[model samples]
Target: MPPRVLHFKSIYLNRSETFIDRLIRHLQRYDPIVATLFPKHYTENLPIYTPSGWWAWRRDCWLKQLNRTPRFLYGLCRRLQPALVHAHFGLDGYRLIGLARKTGLPLVVSFYGHDVSRLPDAAGWQRRYQRLALQGTRFIAATEAMKQQLLRLGFPETRIAVVRFGLDLHQFAFQARHQAGPRLLLVGRLVEKKGHAVALEAVARLHALGIEARLSCLGDGPLRNALKEKAQKLGIADRVLFYGEVTNEQVHDAYYTHDVLLVPSQTATDGDQEGLPNVLIEGLACGIPVIATRHAGIPELVQHESTGLLVPEGDAEALAAAILRLMETPGLVARLSYAGRLAVEQLHSLERMVGDVEAVYDDVLKCIP
Candidate 1:
C-alpha cells in the first residue's frame, strides 16, 4: 500500500487555486487526503477534514480565544495517520508548525509567489518563517527566483527544491487561432501584481496606433472596479470586455478565440510578485502567442521572441509594440506557437511535476528510521 500524505492548506480550495488541487489529485505513488482550516463546499468529493458551520466557529474561538490547538485537528491527524504533512503555503506551514511537532510527522512546505516575496515583509513573519524553516523537512519553490527568496529566509540550501507547476497537455491541446482581428486575452485576477492597469494602457495604445485590438480579461479580484475605471478613462472600455470570474472550461475556450495571450505581471507596491503564471503555460500549451513582461519567473519561461515575446514589466508602450509586432508578423506568431508548445511539453507536463513531487516525498521519507 502507498504511504498516506496529508495536504494542508489554510483554505482547502479557492477558485484561483486549481493548481493545488492538481497536485493533490495527481499523486499516483502516494495516498492523499486534505486538511484545511476551512474547506470549500465544492470539495465534498475529496477525502478532506474541516470544521464546518458552528464547529468552525468554535475552532476559531479555540484558536483566538483560548490560544490553543483545536482538539478536532489534533485528533484528525492521529486518526488519519499520514506519514508526512505537505503544507501548500508558507503561512499555512507556519500555522501547522506546532501541529507537526506535536504529531511528530515530517513536514514539507511549498512557497508559491506571494508567500516567498510578500509574506516576508509582514511584521513578525521573518521570525515565524525562521521557525518553519528550521522545522520543515523539505521546501518546494516554483522557480529559482523563488528559491533565492527562500534562501534569504534561512531555509537550508539542501532542503529547498525548485518545482514548476505542470500543465496537462491533453487538457490544454494546441489549436491554431486564425481570428479576424487581434483578440488579446489577459487571464488573471485583476490585481496590482497581475498588471491589469498596464494591460489596459497597452490596449489603449493599440487603439491610438490605429489598430483596433479588442482585449478580453478573465478572472476578477479587489482591483476589478479600479481596472474598469482605468479602462473607461483610457477610452478603450468599448473594446475591453471584463468577464469577471468564469469556469476553467470557459478560460480554455477563450484561448482558442483570442490571438494573443497578454501576461503583464509585475512587482506590486507591497513587494508581491508572481512565481510563474499558469496562464502563460496554459496559453503556450494552447499554441497561442504570448506577450509577457520580464518579471520574476516569467523570463524563465518566455525567452524573448523565442518561446514568446517579452517586454519590460510596467512598460505599456513596449507591451503595445509587442502586440503590434505579432499582428504584423504572422511568421513570428507561428514560430512562437510551435516553440511555446514544444517548451511546455518538455518542461511543464503534469506527469513530470508529479514524478518530481513524489521524488521529493521519497527523499523526505528515506530520512525516517
Candidate 2:
C-alpha cells in the first residue's frame, strides 16, 4: 500500500498565505496527503470536517463515550492508518498530541512564528509547549533563530529540524531593477508586529526629504482602519495606497511594479514577532531590493547590504533613509536585487526544502518502535 500522510490544521486552508498553501501542495508530491480541517466545504483532495459544527449534532454521543476526540475523527484516523500525522502550527499541535497518544501514531508539529516567539511567553503556554516538545515525535522550525528560541525554552535540540520557507523561483519571474520614483511596497497583515504604521511614517519622512515616493500595503487585518487613519494623519494619504486583502497574483504583480519592499518587523507588546515573513523572501525572489528591519530572522536574509539592506526596527528615520538611499543609487539597488535572487535560488530552493521535510518524515517513521 502507498504511504498515506494525514495532515491536520486548526483552521481551514487560507490561500492568502502563499507559503502555507505552497507547503500543503508540495507535501502531496511525495505522499498521498489527506488534509483534515474544519472545512467550509473547501478542497478537491480532502474535506473531513464541515463548518456546520462537528459537535453540535454529536454532543450527547460524545458525553456518553469518554473519548477526548470526536467519534468521527478517531474513526477517520483508524481507517486511513496514515504513516504519520503532520500538524501545522506549534499551538495547533496541542490537539494532535492527544490524538497521537490515543491512536499510537507519531505526531510531527511545525512551528512557524507566534507559536515559538510569542506563544511560549504567554500564560499556560510554557506547559503546553513542554508537553508537546516531550510528547510529539518531532518538530520543525522555519528559521535557525526560531530553532534556537525553541531550544532555550527546553525543546530537545535533536528533535527539531530547520526548514526555511522556500518558493518555486520559476513561478516568480525576476527582472532587472532600474531607477524609478521609489515605488515602496509592503505586503503583510495590518498588525503591530508587521510595522505597517512604521512604513507609513517612513514614507512621510521621504516626502519631507524632497524625495517623491508612493507606498502600497497589500493585506488586511484588524489594524487596517487604524493604519488608514495613521496615513491620513501623517498627511501622506494621497501618496499611500492601501490594497486590503489582495490575491497572490496581485501580490506578485505589485512586486514587479515596485522598486523596493519594506519589511519593518518589530516585537509586539504581547511578545509576538516574525518567523521570516514570506513577503520578504518573495520580494527577493522577484529581484527587488528589500529593506527589512533587523528583527527576528530578518538578518539571516538581509545581510547588511550584501543580499539586501538592513535597518533598525520601528526607526522611521532609518527606514526613510534606507528608502532614500535605494532611490538615489540605482546601481546599489540593482546589485542587491541580483545578489538577493541568487541567495534565494542557491539556499532556499523549493525542491531542496521539500526533500528536507521528507527526510524528517522518513526518520520519524523509521524510529517508531
Candidate 3:
C-alpha cells in the first residue's frame, strides 16, 4: 500500500495555496492520501479539517490561537492516522511536533523566508514558537541561505534539506515577443520588502532619461497608497498603472503582455527578504526577460546575464541601466527569454519539486522504526 501523507498549512491562500494544492494533486498520482488544515467548498478526495477557526481571527489573536493549537491538531492527527505529517511552515511544524510526540508519528517541516526572518522578531510568543518549531522536526529550507539560518538556529545540518520552490512550466509557457510598447511588470505584494518603491524609483529615473515605457504594478498591500504617492511625486504616475490584486490567470496574462518583469526585492527593516519570488520564474517561463536584485534566493533561480539581469538591491540607477540595456538591445530579450524558459523547464518544474519532497518524506518515514 502507498504511504499516506497529511500536509498541514494554516492558510490555503495565494502562493501557499498554489504550492499545497499542486502538491496534493500530484501526490494523488502516487496514491497518497492528502490532508490539509483548511476546509474547502468541495471534497475532492482530499481530507480537510477546519480546525480551531484560527483563520478567522485577527493577526495577534491568530498567533495566540496558534500557540494553543496543538490540542486541536492532535485530535485531527489521531483521527486521520497519517503515515507522515508535513507542515509547510515552521510554526505549523511546531504544532505538528507536539502531535507527533503524542502519537509517535514523523513530522516534516518547510521553512519559507518570512517565517524565519520576520516572525521571530515580532516579540514574545512568536519568537518562542519559531524556536520550538526549529527544534522539533526535520526541516526543509526553501533556499541554501535559509538552510544556513536553520543551522545557525541549532538544527542539525543533516536534519535540514534545501528545496527551492518549483514552477509549472506548462501553465507559464514562453510567448513570442511583440511590439506592445515597452512595458515593465512588477508582480508581488505592495510591501516594503518586495521593493515596490525601488521599482517606482527606477521607472522615475528611466522617465527622466526620456525613455517612454509603461509600468504595470500588480498585487496589493499596506504600502499601496504610499507607493502611488511616490510615483506621482516622481512625475511618472501617468505612465504607471496599478492593477491591484489580480487573479492567477491575470498574472500569466500580465507576464506575456509585458516586456520585462522587475523584482527589486530587498531586506526590509525587520530583515524580511524574499525566498525566490515565484514571479521571477513565472515571468521567465512566459519568455519575458527579468531585471531583479541579487537578494536572498533570487540568484539561485536567475543566472546573471544568462537567464536575466541582476542588480544590487535598492540601486535604482543600476536597475534603470539594466532596463535600458534590455530595451535598447534588439535581440537580448529574446535570447534571455529563451534561456530563462529552458532553465525553468529543466530545473524548476513542479514534478522536480514534488519528487524531492517525496524523497524527504520517505527518508523521514524510514527513521521511524
Which structure among the candidates has the greatest lDDT?
Answer: 1
TM-score of each: 0.95, 0.92, 0.90
Please give, for residues 1-369, the per-residue lDDT of candidate 2 as tens digits. Answer: 556667776455666445655666677334545444344323556435422355643652342233233345566677767888888887667767778888888888888888888888878878877888899899999998999999987899999999988799999888878654568899988889999888999999988877898998998999988988999999999999888888878998998988888899999989999999988888898898989999998888789889888888889999998888888888888889899898899767787778888889889988978
For all candidates, what are the clash counts?
0, 0, 0
Model 1 C-alpha lDDT per residue in residues 1-369, reported as the tens digit of each score: 899998877677877677788888889999998876667734856898766578775765467333234456677788878889898888877777777789988989998899989989988889888888898899999988899989988999999998889977899988864322489899989889999999999989989978999999999999999888999999999999999988888999998888899999999999999999989999999999999999999888899979999899999999999998888888888888989999999889999889999999999999999
- Regions of candidate 3 where Cα sits further than 4 Å from its true position: 15-17, 28-45, 52-66, 124-135, 176-181
- Rank candidates by lDDT, best first: 1, 2, 3
Instruction: Please give the lDDT score for candidate 2.
Output: 0.80
Q: Report RMSD (Å) for each prediction in the order shown.
A: 2.0, 3.0, 3.2
Order of quality (TM-score): 1, 2, 3
- Per-residue lDDT over 220-325 for candidate 3, one digit per residue giving the tens place of the 0 to 100 score: 8899999899989999999899888888889888887778899899999978877778778788888888889999888887889898899999999999999899
lDDT of each candidate versus the true structure:
0.86, 0.80, 0.75
